[model samples]
Target: MENTSTRSTSRPSATRVFVARLVGTGVFDPLGDAVGKVHDVVVLLAHRGQPRAVGLVIEVAGRRRVFLPLSRVTAINPGQVITTGLVNIRRFEQRAVETLVFSELLDRVVTMRDGSGQVSVRDVAIEKDRNRDWKVTRLFVQRASSGPLGLRRGETFIVRPDDVTGLAGSLGPQSAAALLATMEDLKPADLAGVLADLPLARQVEVAAELEDARLADVVEELSDDEAVALISALDAARAADVLDAMQPDDAADLVAELPTAKADVLLDLMQPDEAEDVRRLLTYDGYTAGGLMTTEPIILPPEATVATFLAQARKAETAPALAAVAFVCRPPLETPAGRFLGMVHLQRALRERPQQPLGSILDKDLDVVLPDDSIGTVTRLLATYNLTALPVQDEAGRLLGAVSVDDVLDHLMPDDWREADDAVTDEMIERSANA
Candidate 1:
């Protein structure tokens, strides 16, 4: 390896290393004894300038991880890293400001400085400065083929960081087929944990490949900050589509975190009915029943048969809590219905004849809460009734929406429930990649 930076007389030429190839390479001590293996390269991204490589995340014995600061690095060899014998065994925790080069930078999309178009980052080359510090200076990128059939491959080349436009900003589109394949067996909640472990750039890449419905489920499982960041990274059209796919209350919650102008833009781009539902949910304080209720709960007219309610409740799209009962209303069956009548539990429906009118056996005595009611009131009512969901009504006795137990739990749980790091393991990713 050779140094790409300017030569200096004060120190021997520094080594230029490609981060992707550096991972898994052995780290050796002065006496050439193996110490550990490199797992990732850490870099500090400044507001304006090339990112400086600060250190390496290495895996020692017992599957313990540790940080190896660049200052302790001595030399870069063909397939091994030379470091000072002194090593700290503390576990590595990625700070908010630090980025892992291989997991974050590789496969990122950036625009060429010459206006050639967008390119995907294949690898990044880092070299030591005159002071023996490492900094990312070269990007190995590939432009998408413009051929008639895309039969020809894109051109691949290396350029300085200044030669690209979007490397320092929010993430852009990239191919995520491989990464998605690695997650093929994961459920949405488990998949969300794996994604949370990834950097924002990788999250955006995977988001671009996921179907809107699946993406919506995964986003709902993320923390507020993580959800907002991932949603904001997608293009406007797709972002609105994803919002439309999400439940009204969840969509409203995410939009509430975005800037006012951006939120308005996305809501306008969404389907009219979907946007209206989310808009109504956003009007109430987050701690009120109105904010936690979903506008799409299963609703039926008084004349609807028990059979009809059963089919509606069985739809795969209906949320589990909301599907536990069917809300029977007057003339209009949609939300803000003509008049709130009663609810029919699925258990009761199963015990009655299919031809029986839902209203005939409905639980008119079911407890209800006003939209303006506090979350505490809603929680007490649900617990008091042992109900999975409770109806919200207006002063005129019109049904507005239904608040499910999941909605209350989402607010009551710790804010970082979805960020548990152990949800996905390094061994899982390695096996998936190899498979």
Candidate 2:
């Protein structure tokens, strides 16, 4: 492969070569003394709103890896990196703001428009931006390396970063707002991760472009801070619409995380029923049953048939998670849920005739809790019985809503779990009726 740039800054030429060629190239001082061999290049993301090379890791002796700051670098080409010989002897530690191209980026699948079509990164091409700062401008994509085909026509084109999209459904930086109009059926948390990876400007653009309902789903997967940041970017009406689209429990959590004035405005903008649901949940302690339980679950009347249960389960497929059990309750479906009949495990509905009523199929040994029940009690109830969901009742034994295990996990896991690299996927959601 050909490459460009030269030892003299004023001298320019057309040269092109893969970045990997620089991996083991020898580094030298201005006097031509050998400083070391190139180990890796360090890039600071969003440096000037684009990833830019900031430093390099060079091996001085057999064991010592020294940092060669970018300011000391004079030239970079296909197989060689020239430095001013000055180096920091300290060992390299990747800062949160920095990433090693050869380590964090290589081989990761990047996509366009969410996860629609993807390209595997063989190498990233760094070029001098208009400011003369080294910025990652293109990717050497391995088009069809995984398939039986060796390499196709479009297999090795070098395209700018914006041309690529998601990494396992993540949104890459510089993705067009139009491409994001279609979010491709992705898990909310996965979509959130992609959103988190985008630059703030593009993220806001996508925010304005996304449907309120879809935005709500993706927002539910983000941290309260990130969710608030994105929501604040939209018009007040759109923000309220997004909050309304989210489940009442998750909506309440996101709202609670916002400023009082912002939350109040959103609540005021929401429909009375939806606003009231979130307000009620907000009043409860986040770690308590009232907080852990969703205001909406599969609630049914005793007279509701098995067919009705199946239909509800099917509708819940569109939701982030489904209630594993259906609570048979009286009218008002609210906190003082009127009279509570027992619950019917959704699994039992499959065994019985669709035409049959649910009353006869209720679990005889039901363990229920009040909204004020401690989180420990709720966790024990869910774990001990291997129950996928537990009913939350009020003082009157009225069924309010069900406490799903996913909610329990949400309350119990680390604060940053939604952004965790191995985020909990929609397996919990997919098993809408799983026990």
Candidate 3:
């Protein structure tokens, strides 16, 4: 979205506002009731262009922080701010192209454009551009002291952002820590995009900072090459832990991308239970039903009650596609479940009495695919039946995992689908339409 956070560059120009002064300022709604305090200013930083102030991070009641898009702000006066009162409650997330001014740029040391010595940044000034965009235009800096025992305070001056170097370079751990805080609200796919935009060193740093489970989710959304590179960058113990946290099918796919020896080493390091499932998946051809299916689909005995099924489906960890249908089998409820019976769609279960058995509402007529079935076959079966997930069974009628439509689409899309230009164009189109 286009951010108009600063006052318009009009006939009477507004004063050059130093972002440091805005922190801790009280933010109020249209009715003059206090809502929150400004904690930080978010800016869109560009390598060769002016950095635009996009929004303010405001700390509300309960100490929760939310992003206040510049478009929502009505006025920015000394010691106080006013908003349109309509605010999104979602937590603030820093996009890949953006940075937090206070957390990243303050106290940064930069070299002067001329042959003069280096200076440390004290604060930055932002103003509305000719195009009405709020941009960082000047820097407040202090030259290094050259007096006896460094007792004298260094001279300070206001200089253009272009008057110094090193401002755009990495800011070390502080940058990564702030970036991680902003990333907490991002989805795995979006987080992967953010990681992809970083330099290799920064990518590794951020990946290392993530918890194993979160790292696994993000890794699954990355391209094979990127996934391998990221995994390789981690220490063996942590890498195996992340792989263990990943879904079996996804873990298998990533493992297959690694060198044989490295893959073997990682698999050995994984928990036996998790490693077994991934190993089984690795044996299947990438295009087949066994390869694309997640081994953790919801499986229950034929006698499971509607209430029981509903509870299982409602778990926070249950994937929507996998939860849409539950498989009914004989004695062994786990995959390679014994004597596969019919399946029960969630819709069918919802209409039945809580005490009713799943078997009584079984969808027996639905056809199933085998482990060796082709991707095209799996796709056609799902489309033909309009199913979110399709069961895959063996000749002996034993149930294996089910192939989800999402997994099928993942394979069907191009290798670089995440970085596709078409997606970028579509997003731009959407933003323009919203604007």
Candidate 4:
């Protein structure tokens, strides 16, 4: 009766927290005095599950850092981060960072069971059933790193994902932190093959998901023909987006291969100058120097310094289309016919004496091809000089573009047509499905 007449006992809902507010917060000492700032929060999550923070990363001095458990957080507000536990900063710094369990570090470098070697994991194969939770079925070791661990030994170490200790059933700070930092090192060619094998939809999704810089690197690795085919397969809008993300010259080259109507639609979607440059290339015969060359060449005045070149390189928003060599041009827009000078190979530009004038190092005998030169002729020039690239000029000796060795190779030996036949099988399957 006495209790019934009194106030009811109930717990209030906990306050919610947002990531933006948590990112940069001031940590305070037990006395409520400001001490440090939180640098990052470590979160852990279940496989393909939501992320949740469990620990705080605090930076004390310029270099000193420590981890604090979320359980110690007393209050979290826009203005400050308060903790209830009193801990010495020096002691926290001295504490060893916890070692993640072998299973928790899947897809990371880990020692083999034999203790004979190390291997990097590729992926974690998992199993799931309607009635049961998904569990890790096996660990997939990269083929290159599986040699030392015999097949039998590798099979024995595969752990169930659900059974993984230290990392499973948690979507806290540590897991989120680990996931963000995790990266796979893949060769460009290998990555390209993997992307190519994915379903068309998935391929586009993956391409769209990648950061621009990484996408640029992947594009640089693809053969010109492969790049053209990939771009052409995408819908006009998406293809244009990828092209716009690419170097101006690369964008132009791919656009040049498209059918006129489609090409125009894509170009209209691109930036004005880029569209104009690509249109200029489109006017040339596909096999000619003008067609093969990129207009976005790196050009510098003869007086520009190596330091200046490096600075320009750092500031450049995109890689130059034809940067294998940097041309040193004369002032007042003098044509080579007026007073011919030399070209500066990029390697020479980087290593040449800083004080030496660029004119002194010009390769005056640099081979030049006319815009109308045949692909066969270009191939010969490439083989005869072992040149990686050659400049293209008009009859008046005005620079128009430059052709790369890779382009010449594409014009010579094309990719085996067998793969195209396989692609036909896939098309047949899709048609059958539709029917």
Best by lDDT: 1
Q: Identify the candidate with maximal TM-score.
A: 3
The TM-score values for the models, in the order shown, are 0.63, 0.60, 0.64, 0.50
Q: In candidate 2, what are the lDDT values of residues 267-363, reduced to their tens digit?
A: 9999998999999999999999998778778888888899998888887333434545777887765555768888887778999999899888888
Minimal lDDT window, size 10, model 4: 171-180
How much is 352 displaced in model 3, in angstroms? 1.3
Question: In model 4, where do residues sit more than 4 Å from their true spots?
Answer: 1-184, 219-238, 247-249, 257-259, 310-324, 331-340, 417-435
Better of 1 and 2 by TM-score: 1
Residue 259's lDDT within candidate 3 is: 95
Candidate 3 on 335-395: residue-level lDDT in tens? Answer: 7788888889999898999999998999988776899999989999899989999888989
Global lDDT of each candidate = 0.82, 0.70, 0.80, 0.54
Model 1, 1-435: lDDT tens digits are 112233332243348888878877999999999889987799987768778999998877644558999899988898999999888987789998997776677777887666667777777888998877798877777767553434346667677788777786556456775446545778888678667767676788788889999999999888899899998988999999999999999999999999999999999999999999999999999989999999988999888999999899888789899989999888677787879889999999999999999889989886668999998899898998889999999988999999999999888654644432333344444454476
Model 2, global lDDT: 0.70
Pick by TM-score: 1 or 4, better one: 1
Between prediction 2 and prediction 3, the one with superior TM-score is 3
Candidate 3 vs. truth: CA RMSD? 11.6
* Clash count in backbone of candidate 4: 13
Model 3 C-alpha lDDT versus the unseen true structure: 0.80
Q: Which stretches in model 2 have alpha-carbon errors above 4 Å?
A: 1-175, 178-185, 316-321, 333-336, 418-435
